[model samples]
Target chain A: MKGILKIAFKLLVNDKGKFAALLMGITFAVFLMVMMTSIFSGVLRSASSVVINIGAKIWVMDPAVTTVANSIPMPDFVQHAVRSINGVKFAVPLYSGSATLRLANGAYQSVSILGLDDTSLLGRPELLEGNITDIFAENGFLVIKDSEINKLNNPHIGTTFELNEHRGVIVGIAKVAANGLFGMPTLYTTYNRAIQYIPSARFTTSYVLVEPKSVELVQHIKDEVKKMGYVAVTNEEFRENISTYYKYKTGLGTNILIMTLISFIVGLSISGQTFYTFILENLDKFGALKAIGAKSRELIIMIVFQAGFTALTGYGLGVGLCTLMIGLAKMRLPNYASVVTFGNLGIAFMMVLIIAIFSSLIGVRKVLKIEPFDVFRG
Target chain B: MAKTAISAHQLVKWFGEGDARTNAVKAASFEANFGEIFYLVGPSGSGKTTLLSMISGILKPDSGSVTIDSTAIWTLSKDELADFRLNRIGFVFQDYHLFPRLTTVENVAIPLILKQRDWDEAIQEALRYLEIVGLKDRAQLPPFKLSGGEQQRVAIARAIVSQPDILIFDEPTASLDGDTGKKIMSFIKDEILNENRCVLVVTHDSRIFEYADKIMKMEDGAVTTIENKSEVK
Candidate 1:
């Protein structure tokens, strides 16, 4: 088996031009696949950035909410009801809304504002500078230092901006786990102040953030919340719901899927055609091997080994190339949202495996049909 | 008495169907003994190759059977027949058929590799066979790098490396000049043939026919004559 595999390898690589062409086809396919899926994965993660960054155990919201960014304001009674539920350690009204900020440059920019509970400051972003207590001062706000921070002229602690004719001071510079998908700067303020600064519906609570007393009581709390015509979901479930909404209900998902399928087809056609040509050209040699006593099974193994080796090599090259490109893009363009995840890798790997199998089958069919007599008769 | 190594009993083969049907080999019966060079000669389309294919266990005869060393080859299952070919026969093609990517020694090691021998041991054994063909110095070169005669010698070395009981050469010298052909035949007669092995040569190249101990002639699809060279002499 070792010797046969050695022969298989030699046969594949000895034709350097064909081998290189085969690798390039698969490598380009894998690059496109990983790039498309990674960008989509990153987009999904960014779309749920609020849930990921807030790190809440449970969120109580209107049942109609599909994503965190598109939150439907819940009435004040919902938060009070959530707080009254058994197993609820605490429930705070979270105010999430968009507001236009007038930067120091006098240019207007859209910003996402999150209002934490005034007393507990639950879900406040970690401060990179200044004191967290400063958020309670008059007109106090924490500016999140993310990719879009420069939109507000890169505000630091003590930087002041105008919102709805009200003075807003950056009391602290903060960092969160993920940046928003939309190109908007994020601001953190107290719940009462947020509603005061930004005009909203009569009900200003976007979601009721809940912390259960214990893990075992989470289901019971969810059941209790459901009776109030609101949905209760854990942090992970909320993120997943956002991901599902974006993936199934948006054109982005279909576009990415189509691109990935096209990449697979391109790789499959090129590799399959090239491999079939290679086998046709080597038909005489295969016939000779057959005539000299190589079994059909052995020939099939040789073809499979050749295809699998080429596919794996191309897959590695593609992943490496995509990683390098993504890294370089993120360095030069901060807003570049593409991440390489294990799921992306697995998808590309499965596609490459399918390409290998399809190509080898093409070659194997041609090889098995060859008769030594036909080869020798010539 | 010389022991029989190959026996074909009234073998027959045909191709196509209906109006296009053609008999490739018909009732061909013969015996090839150990320690002698047996030649099957015929014109183009005279069924020499078809008969050889059947006798070598590659093409199944429509009727009758072939037995090598008393084992009916046609009666074995497909896999068993393949194993039989791998273990009991050594075939050399008209074009040498050496894999161009492989070094001469590696080409010689193919049969041993197919037999599941250790790669290093097969290479070592192949080198020994290359040495026997007087091409040990060129063992590292690819088949295309070697001269036609040298390539044919490599093919011969590859065939005999497995030490099979029956050695079949199909038009061994069809592509070579007369002197090279005679030299290949001489090399085969001198170094390859032994008391325990049967050597069969299929060719219409009469220039090297003098080396054959017995020559079987075919016309159309049937054996026309069998000549014992020593007896005639």
Candidate 2:
């Protein structure tokens, strides 16, 4: 009713400081949730292509690729049997091993050396920088695009570096459509050289490229690969495997859940407490409103309206601040992206609104208890 | 046989219950007519406030009935009681219960807003009352920023702004000095004589006796006497 609104506005404007603080609390909580969720989504989106970038529609691992982190070595002849399956385009064998990339300054960085088939029809780098002929001809490595490319703090087109106890040249940089799942800075080379660098690496553990004739035949190809005593997974399936590992095993999801809960409690407690005090301070005015013809139900509407407005204002401000933070993050967070999607913003808004409304319940209940007669008494 | 604005019969209100019950207003009865300044005079704790609260439909008596303009409120449901209270009664408290956060005019406009009047119209009406109370110049000052007497006038303005049928005051002059109380009582008397409304004051401030059209005295838990109508106006 008009009377309640008039009074509500007066009360809010009177104690501007308290209400401002309450709105700030709500905004901060919502901002954190929005920012965190966006980052999670962004990282998950880019991490799904680890196997896809190897130009493989169907991957054949040695039945021991345990939950994305595992890469078991399979016998190199598995490619021959996979190529004999119907709807099989071609099969390229890939040998994989890990070693430390020791720079000239002795700073060691972990790298994965992938031994690829030179005579196959799949799995090639899409170069983004430097010369591809130098990379193909010399004993060298190709770095990933969108990565920091400093060699001893200065990047040269033809820099020679010793990595994994062997000296190799940095021929070129290329960006593949897919990146590695386990984040081991993968470098590709001929199958012969991988064994020379890491001897006893005779068998290639995985098949890099196997294109299905049609989308419907993908499952058929996977089933054929599984018959060979190997685990066959599609590109999308491989990405899911990696995502499932970090989400469940690394406890990253649990950390986010806890922080979100903490934000809820903190926002609710502060907003609710101030709202209760606001009601108490204006009890006499409410009683007067009752005396003036405001139904108890009408007063309830006023409370809900105030709570909704506060939440909206807070959400808008919080999102604005979070956007500013994200802009700053893009420049500061080395190769890190904090993605804020529409869905993330929507969910964050809902969270803040729920907290604001829940906190307001206490204050509204107290308002209902005030009696018009109380105004006439002490 | 004047048209009765308020009627209470055998109204009994008790505080607490069982082993600790204290009788506040025991079987009290009264009536008042339109265009009259009525007073309930007594010492503190003499059931004056309890009687006024009952008349205002704020506190329901344990036994007996209250009728406003011949509509028996006791026969109605709780929501009906609230409706009757809100629509028919306006109140002034002893401590000048103005909303300290709002200006004098905004506080006065509250009931009108509660009545769902247009915001500007409500403010205009409230400002009219403020002018009547000689606070037009102080319309924008928050109640807390005003003097004690000015605040009391603002409370009075808020009470009468809606133009209710009945106006009830509980020690409206209690917190003010004698001269200010006299002025407030005179203003209240003029409002009763000129506005065709019923006004009741429950007060221990005997200095206001000259402004009353009728004076009822209470003692213990009952009405003791009714003074004859006066010509204070």
Highest-TM-score candidate: 1
C-alpha RMSD of candidate 2: 3.6
Off by more than 4 A, model 2: A1-10, A35-69, A77-97, A104-107, A112-127, A131-135, A145-148, A165-167, A174-202, A207-211, A232-236, A341-347, B192-195, B229-233
Worst 10 residues of 1 chain A by lDDT: A369-378
Give each model a TM-score: 0.96, 0.87
Candidate 2 docking DockQ: 0.56
Give the native contact fraction of candidate 1. 0.64
Instruction: Give me the runs in candidate 1 sitting further than 4 Å from their true place.
Output: B229-233
lDDT of 1 by residue, A1-378 (tens): 999999899989998889999999999999999999999998988898999888899999989999998889988999999999999999998889899988877999999999999988898888899999999999999999878898888788889989999999999999998888998999999999999999898889999999999999999999999999899999999999998898889888999999999999999998888888888878899998998889999999999999999999999999999999999998987767798999999999999999999999989998999887786686
Give residue A189's error in model 2 in angstroms: 5.3
Q: What is the lDDT of residue A290 in candidate 1?
A: 91
Best by lDDT: 1
